[model samples]
Target: METSHDDDSLVNFADDQDDDLDIAPNPDRFRDAVLYGTDWTVRTLLQQIEQGNIDLSPNFQRRDAWSSRNKARFIESVALQLPIPQIVLAERKEQRGTYIVLDGKQRLLTLAQFAGGFSNDHSLWSESAKVGPLRLSGLKVLPDLNGKTYQDVVDRAELGQFRTQFDNHTIRSALIRNWPDEDYLYEVFIRLNTGSARLSPQELRQAMKPGPFTEFLSVRSGDSSVLQKILGLTAPDFRMRDVDLLLRLIAFQTRLPRYKGNLKPFLDDTQRHLNASWSDEQNNVVALVDRIEDGLEFLIKCFGSPREVGRRWDDKRFDGPINRAVLDVQIASAFDPNVRRAVASGALDLRAAYIDLSESDLDFGQAISVTTKSITAIRCRYQSWQRALEKAVGASIQMPVLPNA
Candidate 1:
């Protein structure tokens, strides 16, 4: 789902055209079909199974490995005339598979498992004893015309007639695989998935986009061990999704305030800017991350016991305190080259100074007042240090310290 717009509005450039098709055709005539009120049957399922078209992407809900209670409840829903979710499937003319599941993978898996006499528990029907392959059976579907049940028609059937009827039942299928017709797919996906475990645009992008940076962040932030450590320090209830957003904020050094839950477009724009502004030596992103990491080490040394800080090195507070310090460091370093040298040579005693300054009896407001003065002093000291270093190195380095903004 690539688009060229902000989070509020998605502007898809390609309309309804096949990926391989070069010719542009009428968009109105090439509409996605919606088939309803038909019995999805065993023969179609078997055909799809044989065609290698069934996609159980991790994005889909977990397999029907539900507890016995949940399985019983689902069966009871069908028995008690409760409305179950309609399965969303796609039918393609070019594809042999009768259906491409858009939704309802769990329900379908449960049905298939039950019909095959596979036990929900770890018994014969479980992995041990291979029960016969599952197929829809004993299903008493009601007729649409009247309230006639499968039992009413069963009496008029011969031996194996029930299986034949079940196999030949008309199954409703929806087709949506037109490459140019992505908007239609997007609209349909949105309509069907909205309000049901609604995934944000950034979340969706993380799933869809292809890039090393996205992959690396996903691994680092999505790891259960890493997440557990982060939670132990910060809010344990904080979602991994939020962590990803914070990473993007740091990576781009965006001045944007705390995200108001609309991060998709912001992420997209940031990625675009990063891709354009990226350079090998002057890679602000890599430099920014390294600086934040260094600053975090300093904060931990100053604010907590060195042991505790190192143990909870990836704490969320590191982002707030240490990352901010790194930002200031970068700003100060720009005006005084020796600030970078001090950072490199450990001349400024960052950890000790940070600890001494932060532990003072001052509220955040008071601390900010002192911090402002301290930063000015540090900047001045760096300018003097740079001149001395320049003289020793026999290379004149100009310092341009900007006035306070």
Candidate 2:
């Protein structure tokens, strides 16, 4: 695992602690009349799975966390006609007729696997073992099911009745049809998962809010080649820390001046906009990603391996876990097409300028200041970096400014 801070850059945006804001209080606050739907049977739910209606690859939690033994227990529970907990699903209005799994992924997956062989896609199914006859064991109440596979139960004439009963079993499901407000959906996800286990905001956001940009981030962060070359990480953080860094870079580059003190809300708003699936925006995303890659490559060529582009960024003096503010400013600044051209054409003495700028304590300190999330701090840092880059490249490129200023 990469050495991330105990207090991660993304985790400690405003403060290390989460505020106790009373955003929603009751079931009525969820607007149950319109969005809520009643429970569903295991049979009906399986039909939806077969029809390709439910989304299993929500980028939130690791899939198939439950062991085969755990799956066996659940399958045994179903056979005994036990009343399992309800599954919660969020209907994706934007995708039109698609639903994402919010909770009960394990239970739903167990039921499906028992019914049919596992699918090849690991995301769709919970476990790695391909769809085959489910083998159940370690049961206490239903001792007869011990060491029995699904085929055994189905083939035996005497046990045939048991199979029929198991097939007719039901599991409750709560459908959230319309989460009108983004904040409301955020709150709902937090609320729903609190009882079972705590899920980080990033995890919930990835699962609940699946979109084009989020998908892009997932792919970009997962690319080991890029991550290994630039960030100096042999293995990516399974918790998706790299993804968070990429998001922070995009937010600062595109929406820095408008940034308020809070990072989560700012990121949330930016993500909602990016999720709109605009053709032009998609093209721009690709371009920005390419520019970032090019910039990182340029740094590596100039400075050699384990290229430290930030955190006291000089060829000789580079050390420390890559600073967040430094990373944001440098990567965002590198997105300029003119900057890329200058480096390529030898117009920019990037090696000398970058090393010189790194040694300037006065300039770098302002950017990596204590209250770094504030608008003043964000703008100051970005402008400082941009000015340095412009000077290095000898270009009069116009930079983005605050709307009012």
Candidate 3:
């Protein structure tokens, strides 16, 4: 189900909305969602870090993705007194004054490292531990400053001038506080990070809003048997597209005709709701997972391989990306009580009958021709498949009422 703002404006799941998360909906809450102050100097930020006020955990960032060279460049940029973007932070209730880094993690970490705080093992500490000394090399602007570590600058007044400049440099930080809704923070993180990093929707969800349902998806996505049967072993899931496909299946199983054409938002809403209801909705989750597992096993039994099932159209070859259009419908039909009875009674040869119908059905081609993103097309294809399957199995199954029908 999609949620709206206080004014009933459509809120995009992947984007930030200026809405507060009070059940009573107050305009003042919206205005007070985030709290910011005047720009802070680099020195003050370092002091905050030293005082154990800023949390620099790898909650959202790719750990250690930045190279030493990259860190050097950033430190050099700071020393040169170049302007940088404001760091976004979120205040945690666990610590009254302590804040968590939402954006600008790398920049903040680099500064902390330059001040002799980041341990070589990839953690920033409040104490100025000397486990790993900050060093800068390969300087284009100042060749003399090359190969100088933070210790070298502290010892030399001339080099210390640059260090002083860097310390005094102002880095703005915007703190988000008094926002009771974690969902809004997730949306904001997605919007801010997606522009610079090419994080897939699933990846962004995994990083920004990890929950019980997300953990469930991650575990199921790695099930070798299910994936080998559905997506071929070599199916490159670099972007976590397989997880997305599973999410699609789950979305359809749960939300059905309630789904509109907004694919991303629908998936987002489904996941959010699932995560929210994870404990209370355990039975639904179990039933849905069991049904899908049964459907996949049944499909594999009939087709030999999940990859063999697709929208055949006029071609003798299976085509497209596993054709979810075909999968969703076939699974729904296979689970039909009448169809199951026919199969159990040896009246339905699912494979042979399905192949025959695909070869002869003109309407099936038209149904699959509609864009997969269209809800109408998805429903049409499912209905067409159900009709074909009913004829093949000699089962008279009733169609359920769909949303917006």
Residue-level lDDT of model 3, residues 12-104, one tens digit each, is 211112111213444665575867755888888977866657755432122233557777877888888898788887787656778766667
lDDT against the true structure, each candidate: 0.38, 0.62, 0.63
In model 2, the clashing pairs are 117-131, 118-131
**TM-score attained by model 1:** 0.37
> Which 10-residue window of candidate 3 scores lowest in summed lDDT?
1-10
Model 2 ranges off by over 4 Å: 1-39, 57-85, 91-99, 113-169, 177-180, 194-215, 223-245, 255-278, 291-327, 333-372, 380-405
TM-score of 3: 0.52
How many Å off is the CA of 271 in candidate 3? 0.3
Error of 2 at 13 (Å): 8.7
Ten contiguous residues with the weakest lDDT in model 1:
10-19
What's the C-alpha lDDT at position 332 in model 3? 70
lDDT of 2 by residue, 23-62 (tens): 5466665665245556566667877776667755533223
Cα TM-score per model: 0.37, 0.58, 0.52
The best candidate in terms of TM-score: 2
Question: Model 3, residue 355: what's the lDDT?
Answer: 73
Decoy 2 TM-score against native: 0.58
Rank list by lDDT: 3, 2, 1
